[model samples]
Target: MGEKRLNERVLSPEEFVSGYQYITEYLKAGLPLCDVLKRALKYFEDQFVDSYCTIMLLNSKGTEFVNGAAYSLPDDMLEKFMHIRLFDGLGTCGTAAVRGELMVSPNVHNDRTWRSFANVVKPYGLKSCWSVPVFKPGTSDIVAIFAVYSKYSRYPTQRELDTLSAYNELLGLIVSNYKIDDSGEIEQLDLNEDDNLNSKTLYVESIKTGLKNGEIYPYYQPVLKSDGQELHGVEALARWEHPEKGLVPPIDFVDHAEEYDFIDWLDEVICRRACEDMKKLMDDTGKTFTLSVNISAVHIRKQNFAQRIEDILDETGFPADCLAIEITETSLIDNLTEVAVTFQQLKNLGVKIAIDDFGTTYSSLNYLKYLPVDTIKLDKTFIHDVDKSPIDRRICKTIIQLGSDLELDVVAEGVECDQHLSIIQDFGCNIYQGYYFSKPLTLEGWKNYLEQF
Candidate 1:
């Protein structure tokens, strides 16, 4: 026990065990993630008063977020704390992960450990720390982090560590229950209230707000030719420039939007914005090229979604041949035959389809044969290691051959260095996009960039 505990008086073993069991039962009772975290927080606070606690679980992207049902943090600062990643030398949680050891820091100011995050604790007047990685059930994959912060400098005693370990296992089950095996469908996970179906509707509204407020804009990354010197059309990536917060990357928020069934709105906003910019590009430069927009599986599942596409294309006055609709492997699965019929209508309208993030899913190749799409975007990973590995080269060659057989355009994404280009180009494949050509440019920024060179 710490000197603080010694002074506060000894904790009975039963009292400590009761606290752990209470946290366990609270988490195991199918409580939402936020509630579970909150209960754990309150339990520790009551058991050991004056202690502040946080539990962050891995978001879909394995990124940061305090499980909401669990943490009652201020919304204003939630993003700040949630953004703290668990990585080596990142912060207390990260340091603990790297060493695979329990971390206890009694001094916030003087400790050289995780000095980078000193600013985080300084504001809250927190000087002491304890963090442990909550491993996934039966696997070493870290699922979440349990952390304790105290306003005082005294460290945690052994009882706290033992109690937290069981709590972590219980939390992992909460997360595992919500894991959607559906590889690509947006999950409507209400960490606190899954019973309330209206929560998904609310999630949709948030994504809409993200769209209405200029939180979403197009970022253009140049596509390069085989020579690497020539620039082709720029890929219009949706960039979310949040008003209060700065840029929120797609990886950070896209799937969250998808989960709310508002992925339709995201597609609508991006498609509309891209079409508008495409018009401006033609007027400014007189150079016509293709702008591929990613389509969510949710939208594709709707038989009428194609009609919306037609309306937007007509409304924007962008050339039909100039736009490409990119769908993932899991798209249109809700009604496969119906999706095929819809694609035919799209093809008649002169709209093209390219399977986005291809090869991430095993069924992607199979999906292509069934749908009469015009393109296949080789996922970034294959392009990343195209030349280095034999298997990667074979996959690249296979995809190129497949595209050739289908008379489809095979586009490679995320080409960075010269070797990545050489491997793709040598395979006799055409069409590539990534930083190798240029990083994603802004709408006006892209226009100026193309005009300059």
Candidate 2:
């Protein structure tokens, strides 16, 4: 096979930061190592053109490679990788594992190291391969191999290699902290949680400063009527504006805040900021709009949770009746009785309550029977495929009916197109929120968006 030269592309600094932040969020969320690896690869593949990525682990004896995760690679090819032993010139990944360094084959056909895998890769038209060994942190022990494949033969620029190296380090952190069980479940090892937090104390402190500096604030995503003709409300989402990293996504740090037992502080900051912003928006626009804020389970379970919310309303002068507190189904699993008490207290203050991401957890429908919920936002997973999947459509229709029978507002989440809107309308869901209307926007962006209406 002849070599085919292709234009080289490198990941921008912003792209690198965003991708790293995105994957770190999953790791912090305690997702399975394999699932996190797959998502990490997907992020890279989406950034690069015609690229595929895979991760393979070193066995306990460090003798052979085992499947960890692969993106868009055929099972037969992945099966071949399982038998690759660590040795010189065995294959790109195998050789990288043995040498404990990065390996590159600009053209697999011309690289003698890939001679043994020629037949295996030919079917997929894999022209180039780059492999980097992921070592255990603070040690030279090889734990995993991260590889990227391309259909066109070309050498990667230095910048591209640097990006790979940066991500390789992150993979090391993930792999070193997690392990796969015999039942194929990803279980977290008994790593000392306190030690982990102590190690990242600077990061935690930075968040505290970030809030005081106004670096952490609220962004709003509009929730519209099912007809897409009028704005029903807006959801306040927290975002971190890192001075150097630009916009750090909430996923990257929200869980970290929760783990460090300071989520209550962060939640209060967001709620107060959102109330102030929404109050101003309502005043300027002369249009009353409901404001929804997601409260962490940690904060909601407190003995004085309702009192704190009432204080923020009093401080910001935001009407209590026009505000909604969205609680996820998973949050209600632990302390339903206590949470219901808080819900009733808030309801007594004229605040509305909403069950966000409803149907994602195993919590019984008895929640609706006991809790004072005014709305249930159907989990986006059901709405995402409502236009195509019969099962999703049925679930959405059933949820809408249930909401109606209970005389509660039903808001469909994740309506991204006209088809989703039409189908949701048919199901009699009059409230909608999703990218179909607009993505979450900064305060200025939200102001501009509302001005148009």
lDDT of 2 by residue, 333-374 (tens): 888989999999999999999999887777748789899999
lDDT of 2 at 374: 97
Among the numbered candidates, top TM-score falls to 2
The TM-scores, one per candidate, come to: 0.55, 0.57
> Each prediction's Cα lDDT score?
0.66, 0.80
Question: Alpha-carbon error at 446 in model 2, in Å?
Answer: 1.0
Report per-prediction Cα RMSD to one decimal.
19.8, 19.0
Model 2 lDDT on a 0 to 1 scale? 0.80
**Whole-model lDDT, candidate 1?**
0.66
Model 2: weakest 10-residue lDDT segment is 1-10
